[model samples]
Target: MKEYLALFVIIAVFLYLTYTIASLPGSDGLPGNGGYISDEVWYVTSARNILHDFFKTPANSPYYTTTLDCLTNESRIVKEYVNINAVTVTGNVKCYIRRGFPYPDKEGILSYYNFEHPPLAKYVIGLMEAIHDEPLFWRIPSMVLGAATLILVFLSARRVTGNLWALAATALMIFDNTFRAMSGIAMLDIYLAFFTALLVYLHLSGRLLGVGTALGLAASVKYSGVFPLFGLAYLYGRRGVWGFVAVFLMAMSVFTLVNMPIAGQLGIQRWVHEILAAISWHTTSRPPGPIASNPLDWLCMHNSFALYTSPDIYASGTPAYLVALVYALYKRDDVSILYLSTYGGYWLVYLLGNHTLYSFYTTHFSPLAHILIARLLSDIARRK
Candidate 1:
């Protein structure tokens, strides 16, 4: 009963926090006062275009260009065109771009949408748009996924540590400004983080099919999810190659399925070409301007990315992460080692690869960090 109560309270708190943050006023492409910007404009609109094309035409109809056009128009509008500018009495002007709306000029020059990231997340957001084309609706998925992630974090921690530690870890994550901010946005990173945490939890439980499904879903949300495969393989390879193969096949299948609508429209050869082009664009893309920081800076919390201003949310866990690192170093337990290795593998990719890295990218590291910190606290309490 005590354990159940703890879980219940944690979940209730998480849900409350997530919903509150997600409900904060933001513009979902509708023109209005007090409208806030979001990356959802691109994702929600692209999903809208894809769904529109998917329904209006047959399954094999060319949605590639349509999706690309939607993405391209959104990019151009947000970057090149500014629709609204507000001036303060002090003679300062703040500019706001119109987002989350379909492209008005059909004849405008449409650049090929990069289609750089995987499509699963956009599809989910698009589904929300289908239900209700509102900004709040678009962000619902993130809020739900964020809450689910907290549950998984608690479960994973409880499995290795205790209920008290699980509760502490969940609370730490729940209160994190970065987690709260991401939970409220229509962005891919939060989804990626949720699936990644689920993958770890499922893997730990020895549920092979669930592992594969989680792994597949994670990668489908964002390619960065592939990083966890290495850690999983290394930790579980002693069982044999069959499990790894299952993970591979399932992940590939999910990836292929989610992309089939767009791929079928483009044909195999053209689809391959588009994917390679996206890779090239990612590799060659310039540094992420002044606001961006390298992997080291993110881990050290030297320069966390600012996601919002009015409430002052940054993509950072800071001293909490530092605490986790110290505890992991001291404990060296199986759970600690597993998370440390997985966390290290994920960060190492960013460290070696050259792309605009944001602090939010560190969101994936939060669950492991929380678990480790919880373990440390649990250990100290036991010793006392």
Candidate 2:
């Protein structure tokens, strides 16, 4: 036990160091820069609003427009983008300030902050605001939690298989620039990714309640986390239908409780309406920006906008990711196979059913992908 504990600590420290190094200036995906997407600013703004005003309506909403002109409009808050109100430099690097919520009044184009997304991620940033009162401060928790996510991966992998495979998986995830950049930010991706991975790890290890709670928390971070619940259904189906329903309801209950109070009963009904709006906006809401082109072309060219644009538009057509998922499902006996299927399934369901896909949307499946890729490489090393 002591040996395992020590190993866990070492892995945790290594993940923290690696993330910190990768997160240094120029690593964050900033706008107008190669590899830097513009969505990070929006997430930072949302996070700030959650901290400052958890109850009030958002202003300067990069996600949805509640202005009188668009209030009745069926528009999806696809990008959840944040409008940076100001940008300043302390020494050599420049820092940005996004227009956040809890504004004094809703005037002049609703240019404060509004609901582009659910409140959980912003709630996280709100926590940061409570502590640091600075943009970078919100990022601190993400870095720490992101490192902790890696540790969970390492430990889970070791328990599922062994140290050799676990170590390999840990190293691969640690070095992946996408994972590093996502973790380095104040966005909900890292938090969602970590909890999603943690939920899967627990379920595979035979901890049912942990899976439920973890998944609930994951969903709370972002709706994307709901994908894994489907995987859980497959795993639990053999036991009995009741068990599956029980756990699912437990997970949903957690999701509902967190969101209900803020949204109110009418808010629940509005979620569906908002979802439709987001979906419609996703396909047709191109407002003549750098990202107005077709998503297929943008994604293929490795463009920054491709990574940051709302999923509503980018997901309009069938993507190759669906084919990959079908192939993955055929190999569903392996846990890695399940991960791939879920990851692929998640993309397909959203893409085919909805109108767009975003760069961070890829993050929805990253936790499963990380584990599968790590384990696959570990197997390769052994065969060699």
Per-model lDDT: 0.66, 0.53
lDDT winner among the candidates? 1
For each candidate in turn, the TM-score is 0.80, 0.67
Cα displacement (angstroms), candidate 2, residue 137, comes to 0.8
lDDT of 2 by residue, 29-148 (tens): 223321222454456554555443554433332322232233323332222223422221122212122223222111222232335455677676666555544435656777777777
Count clashing residue pairs in model 1: 0
lDDT of 1: 0.66
Name the 10 consecutive residues with the lowest summed lDDT in model 2.
87-96
